[model samples]
Each structure stands twice: as structure tokens, then as C-alpha cells.
Target: MSPTKLLIGQIFIVFAIMVLGVWAATQWCAAMLGYQPQLGQAWLETWVFAIYRPWQIFAWWYHYDAYAPEVFDKAGTLAGASGFLGCAAAIAGSLWRARQASHVTTYGSARWAGLREIRKAGLLRPVGKFLGTYAGRYLRHDGPEHVMAFAPTRSGEGVGLVVPTLLSWTGSAVIHDVKGENWQLTAGGRARFSHALLFNPTDRRSAHCNPLLEVRRGADEVRDVQNIADVLVDPVPATDTSGYAGLSDSIDRHTWQLLKGVALSTLLGVGTEISFGDERSDLVRALRQSAQQNGARAGDQIVGRSLDIPPTLEVRPGWPLRVLVHRDVVLRPWRQGGA
Candidate 1:
């Protein structure tokens, strides 16, 4: 039954018991006193006395005179005791019933979702993100729902969960395989389905992708260069560090400035000509001489076009510096000059 109905029923039963106990006690009092009072009069008096003169019921027991044979209201005392016992039992029963009902409600609502529910929700699928095994069947969530896993170290997060999903998943996935174990295990199988590439910074044989190459010449060129510079000069390391922690603030600022200048020049096709001599005229003279040499090389022949040169160029670390000239440019002089 509902809690409200159960509580109402308990209250009615308790009131009835209290009334019956008071009536029985009044009847016993009348018979002992040998007086027949009006109907309901004795009951009313007994209830009033029970409330106001409760001490009178047990007074005779505590202050009993052995020499006197005066009668006491023993029945009233028994009735009061029974009434208290009945109320206590009712309260205990109410608590027990409520506890039992709560347990039933909780157990009904907290059960795991069944196979039918899973299927209805579209979580049981063939090609999708893996959830777990249930009822000897593999469960997958094909819907666009976010999944997260939290597990301690040495647990089979990769082998048990990740590898299984990677092997089954046909869609594109970009995984950060720190130990390279995931690539080693699943690369062969996945290669058959899709083109897989591994990019490791420490590995020399890994694919090379220059971020600077992506910088284009446009209105947003400065913003793109700034973003790349921020990433390069960011002091926060992605993982733990061992030796040579980082550069100081001043040095980092200087490096950022240098990178920004070089990147802007390269992407914008503007070069800062550095002259070896101290005078500004020396730099102008060098440019004039270079132009005269280029004109002489053309030898009155109309040069239809000149190749565009990147204003700035980067030589990656651990590599020998070499000049990169356009194929259309004459290289006979440089070859003979041992340049």
C-alpha cells in the first residue's frame, strides 16, 4: 500500500485501541467502586483523570499503607501500560514498513539495463565505439555519445579496451600512442583498411611535416605566424622534464621576437638585408652591384620571368646549410665558383 494510506490506517487503529483501553479501565473502576455512572460519563472522567491525574493511578502502589485496606485503581494502571505499549508497537511497525518499502523502490529502480533496453537505445551495434560485453554479447554505442574511462596504472586500458575498439573501428582515428605499443599491435591490421601514418618527433625516419609551410601569404598571415610562435615559445612542457628545464622570461621573449620577425619576412616575401660593413651606403652599394651582375648575366636577352624567393628560410637543426635557388635561375657561375 502507499505510505499515505498506510499511515492513515495505523493512526485509526491506534486511536481505536486507546479508546477501548480507556473504556475497559473505566468499567473495571466502576465495578470496584460499586457505582453505576451515566453512559459515557465514566469514560470521559477516566480519560480526563488519565491525562490530569496520571500520578493517582500508581500512587497507591508507591504509598501503600499495610494497615489500611483501601482499594486502588489497578485496572487504570494496566490500561495506561497497555496503551503505551500499543503506541510503541505501532511506531515500530511504521518505521519497519517504511524501511521495507524504500528498499523495494530502490532495488526496482537501480537494476542494470537489460538486453531489450540496450537494443532499443541503439547501443548494440556491429561497427561503433565499444562499450562492454553483456549477456555473452558485445555491446557498442553507435550514437554520438561521449565516453570516458578512468583506470589505474598497469591496468589493461590499451590491450583490453583500446586495442579491441581500434581493431574493430573502421573510421579515422588519431591516437597518441606514447609507448608505440598500440601502433605496433593494431597498425598491421588497420593498414589493410585505411592509410595509417606514424609521426614521431624523436624518430628520424618518421614523416616530416613543417608547420611553417602551412603559413600562407594573406591578411591572416600575421595571426597565423603569431600562433605558431606562441606554440614554439610556450614555456609549459606537455610532459615531465629531466634536464635543462627552460629558458628565462627575457630569453624567451627575445626568441619569440626573432621567430616572429623571421616568420613574417618569409611568409610576406620581405627580406631584411644585413650588410657586413658598418655604413648604410655599403648595403646600398652591395644591392647595386648584385643587380648589375644579374643584368650582365642576362646579356641583352629578354628574361621573361624571375622565380619568387622566400624572404626567410629555416635550416632545421642537425642539418648542413645549403642554398636553395629556383631551377630557372642560372647556376653555371655558382657551380664553377664552388659556391
Candidate 2:
């Protein structure tokens, strides 16, 4: 199947499993309660009524006369105030937990934490994998080198969102099968590579899912600089100031995912994945300038052929960034026993 369709299928499967499990549990609980006299209804009430009762009450609140309080008594007033405080506390507690959950791992062990911890605490596992797998053409992160780096772009343009991806050589060219199992090619040797499936907040209008590719050195770690300015640029419409306002939902719904461990968008608002280094702001400016230089039309993609600035402009020699801008550029799938 095509990559896009396969992505949609995986998403459907995840939700289907979750929903079916919830329904089955509900049925089993109801059946047990109907039969056994010893098992009190308190357990079922806690699970069912405590969870769904709020919504049920809200739905019927206006339809019932019980909400019309004819009493201005001190007791009634105190009860109402307490209820409001309870609701407020619930909301505040939820927001606090969400902030804590989305906390990015900056230093130490969490940076290299295993998949189990990552899938649970990272909170970006589901959609990140969906988008990465699709954009990377079924490749997966081979190791535990996932990094939640802050993108250098402007806030609404795609920065401020904790972008997570495998960014090291040990985290290079990992491939996966149709069942989403990780596997490396038996023949090829390992290479120093970086891969990130980034979504732009500005390009929310366009459907281009940007996949950034940076190639610095091979497995041998030899660095031969190419004509390409170590940066790849795909241009947007020169006139459009809001160059790809990426999926607004992705940013807005991120906090919720932190709390619930669920991803919102699996298909919508995917933008072009351009490969660049830590010099993202500079690279974006250069790509725009290149677009202007090429006389690119509204929908044209202006690809960078060489460095947009001087060689000495911004040099990070030890960790040089490489980029492949074209749609067809494909690197070898990371293999086993190659370094």
C-alpha cells in the first residue's frame, strides 16, 4: 500500500483497539454487577458514573427543573460554591499535569531513555511515529537517541513546539516492516546520519509534509564538503508572508496529548520536511531569498543549489549539517553491524 494510506490504516487500528477495549470492559463490569450480590455497585459507579456522569448531567442540566434553585439559604449557597471550586480544581490539576508531562528531557539519562519510557512519558510517540514512518518511508528510529530539540524558527512558524526525533548517528537510518517492527539491512554499513520529520506551524494552509534530510558524513566519518551550502532549502510563495502556517491544531492539541497520550492529527496539515541544521532561521531566510532569486511563482518550489551566505558566516565544524532538498533524494536504509 501507499505510505499515506498505510499511515491512515495504522491510526484507525490504534483507535479501534482502544475503543473496543473500553467497550468490552464496560460490558464485563455490567454483567458482573448484574449477577453477583457481594460485589457492590460502588466499583461500577466509580468507573461509570464518576467518569460519564458529568457529561450526562451537563447534557440534561437545562432540561430539568432541579437546577432552578428556589432557596437562597446559607447551606445551599455553600454547596453550590463548593461544587464550583471542585470543578475549578479538576481543571487546574489537569493543566498542571499536562505541563509536567510535556516537559522535555534536557540533560542526562532521559535523553537516551529506552522506548518503554519514551512511549509513556514522551507523549509524542503516536503521531511522531505515524508522521516519521510515513515521511521516512517506513524507517524507524533504530536506537534510544531520541532528542526533543527546540527548533530555531520563530514561535508560530514552528518553533516553541518541542520537536522530537532521533538525531544521532546511532539513531540513523532505522527501517521498519509493515508490522512496524524495527530492522536493519544485513548488507550495508552504518553511516553518520540525521533525520527529523518536522511539521511547520506556518504552513498549516498547505498540505506539504516537510521531511528534512541532513547528510554530513558516511559510516567512515570523512567530511568532504559539497557545493550545496550544507543546507537544503525548498521555497514558498515569495509574496506569501505567512510562509506555511503549519497545522495550528498540532500546536494547540500538543498539551492535550501530553495529558492523554493521544495524537490529534495523523493526516491533516502536513508540510514539506526540509533538512537543515541548527541554523534553521538562517536557512529559512536563505531559502526565501533563493525563491526570490529564482523568480519562483506562487506554487513553485525553489530548491537551494549552493550556500546562500558566506562559508565563514556560521560555522560549527565539529558537527556540520548536510541537506538533501529534492523530493527524490533517498539515502540507504540503515543496516545492522555497520558503523
Candidate 3:
């Protein structure tokens, strides 16, 4: 027989066998249940018997004659020896498959920054530029002493990310401007004016103000780039590619917004543990997209092509300062030269 025919024949045979088994079991149960058999002329026939009438089969099998053998045959009913065992085996096989799926695991990293290094780079100032939402978290056990901070992404900028400031609670701040035309710190005031000055974004190595990462051993949590953060001229890829390709553009907008939200809310989940410090750096990093602006709002006028410079993220975690320059920071020569 052809392979295809053999496969079809096997499937047909299996189904036929199941139906036949159910019929046989039903006849046995009926005999044991004291059922009366009805027919035109087969009442005395031994080979031919009703399959669906289990009660009748039981009655036939309930022999009281001393000379007759007390024997029962069950092959077709759902509760018969064969039928019950088949269903039990099927259920057991399904459970084992599910267990195997969970055992197939995958992995990644979260320690993109460290506590000590974030302190040395004067991260507080640069981080503040990007961290707009002022957050104050207090521990009941620590008394009046509490930590005031903000995530970079909460500043309402599209590039919002997952780093926090360490000192914002003690009422201390400084006015400094790096991306002039993108955002400016009002002289002697707390207001951060946007698009008021010239932005001198350049390459990191040339910018000198670029943040760097250092790795080391003796870590508790390990992952790719675990020992320390990697300082690349570019930041994390703004969009993820794991989703379906057919819906990419829609996914791009959705992905960026989701990343911004997560970067803002990751530590706000009520039970997150955090630390604070006084050391911080003023260096900040920003990424610019060719078709969109990173920090501008819907009403903000567009002068040229849109760009997405990621938020001025801290070089390490637990930095005292943060930065928040607009996306326009890319148009300056300082950009490539500083990267």
C-alpha cells in the first residue's frame, strides 16, 4: 500500500476498534444489570447479542443454573477494562507534554549599571535633564529619612528609560545646559526651557563628557554584560523585533511607548528595593531618530526631519543627577565628535 493509504487505513481501523469495543462492553454491563432481551427469534442465540442494552446483557449473564458457567465478556462499553485504560493513558500523556514545555527555558541581563560607578561620573546632573517626574519614596522603618528620585522616561519624553536619581529629596539642584537648542536651564530659575539654545551633540570620545562602563567579577546576579555596563556610543535599540514583521510600523510606536512606560514604572511596583547616594555625574547620552523627535510633544513644530535621541541615561545606577535634553541635540557637530 502507498504511504498515504496506509496512514488513512490505520486511522480508520483505530476508530472502528473504539466503536466496537464500546458496543461489547455495553452488552456485558446489561447482562449484569438484569435486563430482558427482546427480539423476533434470536432469544436463544448465543453468538448474536444486543450491544447497546447493557441491562439486558447483565440479565443474560446472571445465570442461576448450577450446570451453567458464570462468565461475562465486556469489550465495548466506556467503563469496560480496555475503554477505561485507554482514556487514562491519553490523559497521562498530555500532562507529560505540558511539563516538558516549561522545562525549556531562556535567559538575559538587568544590571546595565552599577552603584559605585554611577556615583563617580557626576550622573546626577545629566540624569536630571531627562528625569522629569519628581518621585519621593520613603521607608516607614527609616523614619523621616527618605529617597527622592525620578525615572528618566517619566519626563514625558518619548525616550524615557529605566534609571533613577539618588539625591532629589534633600532640596539641592544645579542649573546646567548641554544641549542648548533642545532644552535650556533658565538662568537662576527651576524652569527647563526647551529649544532655547544651541545643542552641541557630538561623538562621545570627543564630547569628553561621555559616560563609560567598567566590568568586574564577584557579582551576585549574572547576565550578558553582568560584571558592568557597556558604554557604546549608541543606546539600547529603541524597538524590539520579536513581534510579527507584518505589523512593524504599528509595533514601533507601540513598542516605544511601552518601553517608555516600563522605564518609568519598573521600580514603582510598590515593593521594589533601591539604594541612594551622593556621588553623581553630569554626563548624559541622547539618541536621535531620522524621522522623529525624542522629547517633543504632539504640538511641537518640526523644523526638519524627526529624530529619536534616547534620554541622557546615567552611565551607571544610583547616580545623583539626571539629564533631559530634547531630541534636536543631534544636529550639532559635537554629536559624532563626542560619541
Candidate 4:
């Protein structure tokens, strides 16, 4: 399929999953409360009615007290006024959050600008742009954070892996992980390199050994991290030569941010902990073995053969970010500088 059609299909699927998940949640809640599924509808209606009730009172106040009502339903009017004020505050809060999100992107930096030029290119431009940019994530916890992308490799032969580490979570984030260690900061001391095999998606004894692994021993910030992330996050081209050509326009990172944010929030809210179970030890061991195999290497390069496989393997014990089940479409080599 063409990039435009692919994007439209993905948008619909992602949104449908979100809508269905919400509906399912409501039904589950009702069941737990010993109520019928209709109760879910009733609850929604009640909430809407409550918000509408305040509006009704506000309308009453508006007409009666056009200027300033000296005499009226004091309690009802006060309630309506408070609700109206609350709604305004909520809107302001939302704007503040959006502004904050926008600011973060500013720090992340953009690969391109000039929105008008991009719009003129056509719809596929934006869709391909969307696919190219922001198709990955930075999952953070107490220690080093994991930056992942399920997109195709630069070669577009297979879905490759680019696992980088975010060192310190201060002014900016430093990203580098290799040989079972991460670059991190220490309090009242110099930078300390912590030993921990952060992310490994496959078994060592498996056919796809000798994976392409790179390690940066230096400490940097978010600005630096983006440089490495940019390469990994670039949308992989379809193997087929015809259906798609190339991408000229820049991808909008905000769309993925919003979708991932909502999906993650819902996943966490639902308390979904996808674990690899007792086999986790073996996976971690595989990572350790892989790390140990790294004998001597110059600077940051960890010499190993690249894995030729799709992004089907999981790193273990991570939440399901999103489900991408697309139909049959070959992956062609990505054109240099296209993303």
C-alpha cells in the first residue's frame, strides 16, 4: 500500500484500539461494581448531566443578571459561576500542558521546518513524515532510560535495533549504553559508569547472534541523544519498489507523542505488566554473555554482526506501547537523507 493509505489505516486502527479499550474498561468497572453494562452508559450520562447542570444555572445567571445580579438564587448562581470558572481554569491548565509539550520538542530539535512548503508537497508527504519521525520511544525509570524504535534499519533489509541509554536526567539527558554498562552521573563525585545490561531482545544461542551493537562511553545530554536517535527513528522504506517512492517532507513528532502518551497512560492505568516470567533470568544472562564476549574494542564501537530480523522480539518486562499489525508490504532500502 502507499504511504498515505498506510497512515490512514494506522490512524484508524490506533484510535479504534483506544476507543475499544476505553469501552472495555468501562464494562469491566461496571462488572466489578455488580452493575450491568448499561450502568456504564448511565455513568457517562450522569457525568455529562452534571457538567450540563452547571451550564444551565450559568445560563439562568447570564440572562437574569446581565450586568450584576443584586438578588437571585445565591447557591445555584454561585455553583454555576464556580463551575464556569473551573472550566476556564481547566482550559488554561490544558494550554499550559500543551505549551510544555511543545517546549520539550524544541529541545529535542526538528529535522525540518517550513510547514507551508511541506503542505504543498501532498498528503503522503505528511504521512511518510509521520512514519519516519517519532516512531520510537524513551521509556524512563529510576536508572538509565531505554530509547527504542521498532522501525526498519537504514538498509531496510530488516527491522534493526538501536538501544541507547539516557545517563543523567538533569538539564539534558546523556545517551550511551554498551557492553552491559551505561554512562551516568554521581552526586558529589565525578561521572560513574554503571554496569547493567539494559536492553536485549533476542536469545544469544539463537540464529541471529552477532547483533550490531554500539557503545558510547562519553557523557552528554538530550541534544546529543537526539543525534543518535535521529538515525534509529528514521522510517524504514518498504521492501517493494513500487507502492512507495521517497519522503521529502519532515515528519510531525507531536502526533506520535500525543498518541504514545495517551496509550501509555491508559496502559499504566490498566496496570498491565507484561513480563517474560521465569525465563527473564535466561534473557538477562544472554545479555551478560553477549556483553562479556566484547573483548577489546576501540572508542565506542562494539564489534559484532548485525541481526537480520524484524522487530518482533521484546526486551522483556516492558509495557505494551502500541500494537502495529500492518498487512503484507515489502521493505525496500531507505534512500539516504530521505527521512
The best candidate by TM-score is: 1
Q: What's the CA RMSD for each of the models?
A: 19.1, 32.2, 27.3, 32.0
Global CA lDDT computed for model 4: 0.36
Model 2 scores what on Cα lDDT? 0.34
Error of 1 at 215 (Å): 4.4
Q: After superposition, how far is residue 337 of candidate 1 from its true place, in Å?
A: 73
User: Can you rank all candidates by lDDT, best first?
Assistant: 1, 4, 3, 2
Query: Please, what is the whole-model Cα lDDT of each candidate in the order they appear?
Result: 0.62, 0.34, 0.35, 0.36
Query: How many clashes (backbone N, Cα, C below 3 Å) per candidate?
Result: 0, 24, 66, 9
Question: Which 10-residue window of candidate 2 scores lowest in summed lDDT?
Answer: 261-270
Candidate 1 lDDT over 1-339, as tens digits, reads 566677777888787777666656545554554543322233234522422222333443344423223444466565786689678869976886778586465335576787789889887678777777888878777677778878898788777678998898999999988999999999889999997788998988577887777776577776777788777874332121354432321122234545666665443333222322334587677875675555444422221111122123332356444678777776465466576
lDDT of 3 at 220: 28
Task: Give one digit per residue, the lDDT tens place, for model 2 in 1-339.
Answer: 333444455455545544444444333333433423332233334443422211222222234325333321332344345455545555665555456554434443244444465455544433332123222233233335664434354443111121222222333343322322121222122323433222335545323542212323344211211212222322222212366543221122122222111110111111112232235587786865564444433222211211122222222246445777778878888889774
lDDT of 4 by residue, 216-259 (tens): 22353223334444544554432223655334323233332333
10 residues in a row with least lDDT, candidate 4: 298-307
lDDT score, candidate 1: 0.62
Decide which is better by lDDT, 1 or 3: 1
